[model samples]
Target: MKNKEPWYATTADGVPLVAAVPLVDAQEEEEEIPVLVVPPVTTSEVVAFAAAAETTDHPQPSAPTLEESFQQQLSLKEVPTSTTRREQKREFKREWRTMKRQAKQEWRQMKRDAKLEARALKREFRSEKRALGRNLSDVKQDLKQEKQMMKDDAKQIKWDAKSKIQEKKRELHHMKRCMRKNMLAGTFCCH
Candidate 1:
């Protein structure tokens, strides 16, 4: 028998090739030869075969684990407003900051208004105090003038009364002197 070249059959879908070994002409071609040894397969071929076998046997769908179910529930409940949850949170924060800033500005404005009102009231009080002070000083000055006039009138009346008393005393003295003289000359000059 002549030795033949090693035959390589093209494999389908990355499957390993299987070559038929030629035997000596003892039995007809229709007879089957029992295979005693398996063909040597590469490591890559074994891995490919394992992967193909694993793919052929479809695994049954198992129930979700606790972590996976929790993750899925979180994902489902995360966004209900069509927007993302992070975006919604950012919007909420921005609105809150705006409200806070507005409130602070309003508070500051209120304080400024209060300060202005207080200053106005203080100015009004000061003006009133000044006016009252002027009025009090005027009244005091008027009272002083009135008191001086009254003192001058009292002094004038006292001086007039003293002069009148002196005149009356002088008149009395003169009349007494005259009567004495007439009595002394009354006997000799009876006419």
Candidate 2:
């Protein structure tokens, strides 16, 4: 049987560990070369590597405290107490009902006032119309009386003018008869 070569290393805990491989081909059989294996990584070495990778100019963030974390969780939940929530709702409802009642009362009062005002205006307008009608009728009656008086006066003046004209005509005829009689008695006078 050929001698078997160890291809891997083991730790104390039986964990299989590997480091950087030596710069030699394992499958080649032309020449044998000494392999230089690196040691397995330890926890302190890992921590030193991490610290070396980060620069000191920048600050690292600190972990939150227990109390701060608890407060943050509580804030995220933001649950209100049931009793306080109920009281707030009750107050809101009471205010809403009060406002609604006040608005309704104001509306009713406004309607009543408007109706009263309209009725009063209607009565005033009716009274004015009736007064205007009475004044117009009185003026018409006065105008009719004046017109009748003018007609009667005109008729009386016409009758008086006709009687005067008839009296003048009768006097003229009497004078003419007297002249003729004087001429027949031989006492003729030129008129």
Candidates' C-alpha lDDT: 0.79, 0.81
Runs off by more than 4 Å, candidate 1: 1-83, 187-191
TM-score of each: 0.53, 0.47
Q: After superposition, how far is residue 52 of candidate 2 from its true place, in Å?
A: 62
Model 2 score (lDDT): 0.81
RMSD of each: 14.7, 17.3
RMSD of model 1 against the true structure: 14.7
Query: lDDT tens digits, residues 1-191, model 1?
Result: 33344455556775546655555342544454443334767899899999999889777899999999999999989856738888889989999999999999999999999999999999999999999999999999999999999999999998898889889888778777777777887633222
Q: After superposition, how far is residue 127 of candidate 2 from its true place, in Å?
A: 0.9
lDDT of 1 at 46: 92
Compose the digit string of candidate 2's lDDT tens values, residues 70-187.
Answer: 9999998997654787798998899999999999999999999999999999999999999999999999998999999989888888888878878887878777877887878877
Give the Å error, residue 168, model 1.
1.7
